[model samples]
Target chain A: MQFGLSDSQLLLKDNARKFFASECPMASVRRLMETGTAYDAALWSKMAEQGYLGIIFPEEYDGAGLGKVDLIVLMEEAGRALLPGPFFSTVALAGAVLSEAATPEQKKRYLAPLCRGEARATVAFLETGASWNPADVRVASANGRLSGEKLFVTDAAAADFLLVVAREGVYVVQTKAAGVSIELMNGLDLTRPQYAVRLSGTPAEQLGNSEGLARGLQVGAAALAAELVGGMQRTLEMTVEYAKTRKQFGKPIGIFQAVQHQCADMYLETESARSAAYYAAWALEENSPDAEAAVSIAKLYASDAGRTVGNRGIQVHGGMGFTWENDVHLYYRRAKASETMLGDATFHRERLARLVIDAHGALAKSA
Target chain B: MDLNLSADERSFRNEFRTWLEANVPRDWPEWREKPLEESFDYLRAWQRKLYEGGWAAVSWPREYGGRSATLMQQAIFWEEMARLEAPPMANALGLGLIGPTIIAYGTEAQKKRFVPKILSAEEIWCQGFSEPNAGSDLASLQTEARLDGGHYVVNGQKVWTSYGWIGDWCELVVRTDPNVPKHKGLTVLLLNMKSPGVEVRPLRQMTGESEFNELFFRDVRVPVDNVLGQVNDGWNVAISTLMHERGSYGARLHLLFKRNINRLIELSRTFKHNGCPAAQNPLVRQKLAQCYAEIEIMRLNQLRAFSRITATGIPGPEGSIQKLFWSELNQRVQQVAQELLGPYGQLAKGDLLAVDNGIWSYGYLRTRGNTIEAGTSEVQRNIIGHFVLGLPRSY
Candidate 1:
């Protein structure tokens, strides 16, 4: 058994890193975050040209026809660059949902344009309750019409369509459709803007069943976990660099054990998160029996590690880390936002607990 | 990226599993209940059985009485062993650390003489690196050995030597020259434990057992031929031993921690908290689930390390990452056990109501040494800081 990237996967990862480095540097990230929707059309088209927007979509849909591992590899690179846009919402969230649930006709009409960068889409899953559990969904769709408020809907303002998760099933609704209201919320993560979407009798079409939506959420969680790993890695590099150069009394502050041990912890957490996230992606790609538990494990571990690495990163940088001018805060903000996005640590841990309990119960019964 | 076992590996696993199912001592659970000293013979016989089946030291080279198995096979070996709840071999230090060091640095005669016996558990081994004065700063050890008439006259003490009393030989590191740097003046010798003037005094650990000892060497003479490597170059040899310790310990620990966690989960199902099973408590479930994730991460991290070694032909600094993680993760796992079991967890092994025969209690105390032994977590961090991150050494 090999636990590393294959030659092609490595090449894809390297090319993606180089592509993001040139196309979506932190400077561009900052420039775009200041915009109204934090969505750059040119960057979105460039990503589509790279086939990232359709990395996991099938060839029939004019896509790259890659797998989940490939998607995470590209997502990790985008995360490292702090790529600001509707990419994650469009590709990782909405694209995954459509790929998992959409009919062939739906794929041709909706997923194909998303693959070609002609449209943007995102999932509107959370409502007033703000819970990730599909069972907690309160949005109602009746008579092919949606009438509910979806809070913290990622990139809804920038999306051409919204995959609104309703009590009946997932529904597709146009963002600019009559009776649709989208207001961009002040989000902690500047790079990925969230919005409140209000639907009053908006015409919607049911996309797929609850089973497909659940599968899509798992894919999204694993992808976000990979993204968090990238953010943690970059934060670690920045912190370690600052520690080596930033002198305190007589030597570099890194020479101090207090600083060095914390840096070690950061390195440990970042590497561990990478392991968990990559394994989750591989598990999902393989459709392994452990895929559900692996996804929760990845999301749970990365959610905590992302915040911790950010905390330690800022701590090691001392006062400079606190400045709005420093890029460290940007990663810190992203980590904080991502921590709670696709089910926070507490949420996933509880989910894992149930899975473990059921498996053990099954074992006991068999025995 | 492929974690699926190849056909060869799968066949190897099946072969080993069959052998183990047939040969594993059916009385291991009772044998494990015996004191450490009383179980040596049983463990030795187990190791011999493994040796006879050619299952001992699967990762060692073919010439050294091993299958010359791939790293994945070695991992599979450990996994199957844990799965069957097989008894541990008598010569853990030997198989894990000393034999590998000998394979790397020992002379042709040395490998021929020592390697097979280690696998057969004929000559159990213990490392003699840490002195009373040299715990973290191990290179500063002052255990001196002077060359005299083709023999090294050793006169120093080694502390915290595991299996010191039972070991047939010692992989001893000693200072050969006082005029040079502490690190440069060292030499490693394969000293027979039965040598004249050598004394082993049992040191009781916090667990109320003398599983280790303080070894006193009063002018113990070692033949010059017994030196494992070149004179005054024992630092690198000893470092190789420590590297071997960190390199593969995670796979072993994974099975062990897995057992403990499984036991904890079972206990959580029975133990009551707030008028319900502890497993029903949200806080307990969260803790258990977190520990579960951490343990899984530990396994994945080990695989990552193994993948790197398989590619590079040498263990990388990532071993330090595994070392740092599992040591602390085990501690957290134990703490969660105590939290779930409550007051019953504090009972000793002989106590009537002790949980899991007080294994958790013993583990809680014994694992305090995990981070301290092999290398302290602080020492590991220092290594990661200097080696992995290229930071300036704190010292």
Candidate 2:
């Protein structure tokens, strides 16, 4: 069967590329990073106007009805642009959960504003310990009163709402609500700011049914995988370009087998990441039986590939790559942050191990 | 974007599955027993049966006695065969590589004479592109062929020729003009392996398999009509052959990797590590999980490359990307397998107390050739650097 982007998906990707190239180039990214703004409001509004915020949401909810693949296309562009903001936190993490978990009234009240970009939101899934397992949730919410701290929450300071993972289920709390305090963390990746939220008995509205949170995590992992693909791709391109121009000894560094092979390795990693992310997106869209396994595989590869390719990208750039003035480190920081954001490679690998063991057990019982 | 097979492709798979289920030897696993010659004969007969059943060359055109299947169909065919644990066709080199090249470049008469026998396993073929001196830089080959009235007198030595010991024909590349550039002066000829003054010396590998041989020719004569394409253009034909070899069989290789990982998983469940089952060990589990991820990457890479081919109607240098990934991935898989086996890793295949019949040891040793053969990983990186990334040539 055919297993590539359709003509329309290709068109969407190209348009997204052109949009990011013109609107959110690394120059603007660095500018935003310096000013300590979570994101550019003008660019976010422009993205909303382009209907990107609702690429995968239903039109009845003031959104587009495209599939997970279209979201992947957009997320990839966002990562390439290093668009500093709550796009992933707002649209991918929180939006996916709301779309799946929010009741008709809840969706009308919350998701409508999210799709229209009228309100920004982020999800706080990790406690002090950033465990990927839902069973490891330490936040407690009883009778709409939440008491727990969420660390490494992306765009927490900039969000109007926080979808906190509690022992009971998921709860939505206003960022400025009583007993809710948000502190911006001085993290490595300034492009996407991380914040630690301290909640002490904060009044929260319960999002009915925690069933969708697992799917939400899988969807987020898939989208993040797409973003990592973008970062890896740009890093590889930058490294290859630098190798072609940077001379060593006598000829261009690209002419040297050592540098050439390094770039080739980056090339391999980037391509593999792209394939893994795309397939995971497809699997999520189709609700394939292997979606859980596929999501973990994608995240695992993207994590490893992003870090390896980014580090190698820096290595290929020689002294320039080590300096902040060089853009290679920007990708490197983002890659590192994304690798540890939801869960690192080690976390996902263990999840995969469990899935494999469980499947083996099931097969044995049947036999 | 659907990964599942289309209806037609699924039907094609089902047809082959039915034929294979009924025809496959009941004692196929036992076929790998002592008396290697008898095993080879069994495999040859099985391939002939596949030919008669119309399942020998699924990717070949119908005019050449094949199903003329689409890329998806071809992939499904290979995947199914690998799942059934069927032996590779007796004339794999002939059917997979040289036959496609011949179809592309062979004269009308050449195709008529050569295509049918190749599918039927009547003619075994071996490639003679690499020489002792021209391993990676094949254009530097010193093999020479001079044209006479109706024949070309060839004198050359080729190494690492698979199936050379029993090959019926050799897809030999030679220098036809000494005055021109190395690449421009070459010619490709389908040489009769049984010709006078030809010698094949089987080379024992580290794995103890003599599947490859060294071929020496002293004035070996080949009919001028056996030349697939124009003289002095063998370099292009050789490149095409290499491309086909890499592009067409990726799905099959992916299944082979899958089968190996599955076996390794079963082995992990049984093998002991520190007085407990190795499967329960965190490190071993992580390693196995990594193997699964990498293998999946290999399969996805195949699908992406195959998609590009389907869209463009040509297998471009993008195919080189998968070639570079898979060869290295295969080595990594076998290396991990051997590491998991630990002390048993050193045991040869068919050893009395060996795990999985010591397949991991043999696989570990044999997989070294995956990177060096077809094209070295270094050469593959060069291709990606030059063609895919548009980097300047290192040379």
Best by TM-score: 1
Clash-forming residue pairs, model 2 = none
Candidate 2 per-residue C-alpha lDDT over B231-348 given as tens digits, one digit per residue, 9 for 90 to 100? 8999999998998877776678888898788778777787889988888898988888898899988988888888888899978886678778888889889987887888998787
In TM-score terms, candidate 1 sits at 0.99
What would the per-residue lDDT of candidate 1 be over residues B1-395, giving only the tens digit for each residue? 98999899999999999999999888899878688899999999999999999998998889888888987889999999999999999999999899989998999999989998999999999989899999999999998999899999999999999999999999999999889988999999999999998999999888899888999999999999999899999999999999888888888889998877777887788789988988889999899889989999999988988898899897778777888999999999999988988898899898999987888898889889889988899999999998999899888
Name the regions of candidate 1 deviating beyond 4 angstroms. Answer: A359-367
TM-score of each: 0.99, 0.98
Per-residue lDDT of A1-367 in model 1, one digit per residue for the tens? Answer: 9998888889999999999889888888899989968898888888889888888999889899998888888889888988887888999899999988888899899999999999999999988888988889888977899998999888888899999999899899998898999998898998888999999999999985546888898999999999999898899899999999999888999999999999999999988888898899999989898888999999999999999999999999999999999999999898999999989999999988887754463222211
Question: Which sections of candidate 2 miss by over 4 Å?
Answer: A359-367, B33-36
Docking class of 1: medium
What's the distance in Å from true for residue A135, model 1? 1.8
The CA lDDT of each predicted structure is 0.90, 0.86
Report how far residue A134 has shifted in candidate 1, in Å: 1.5
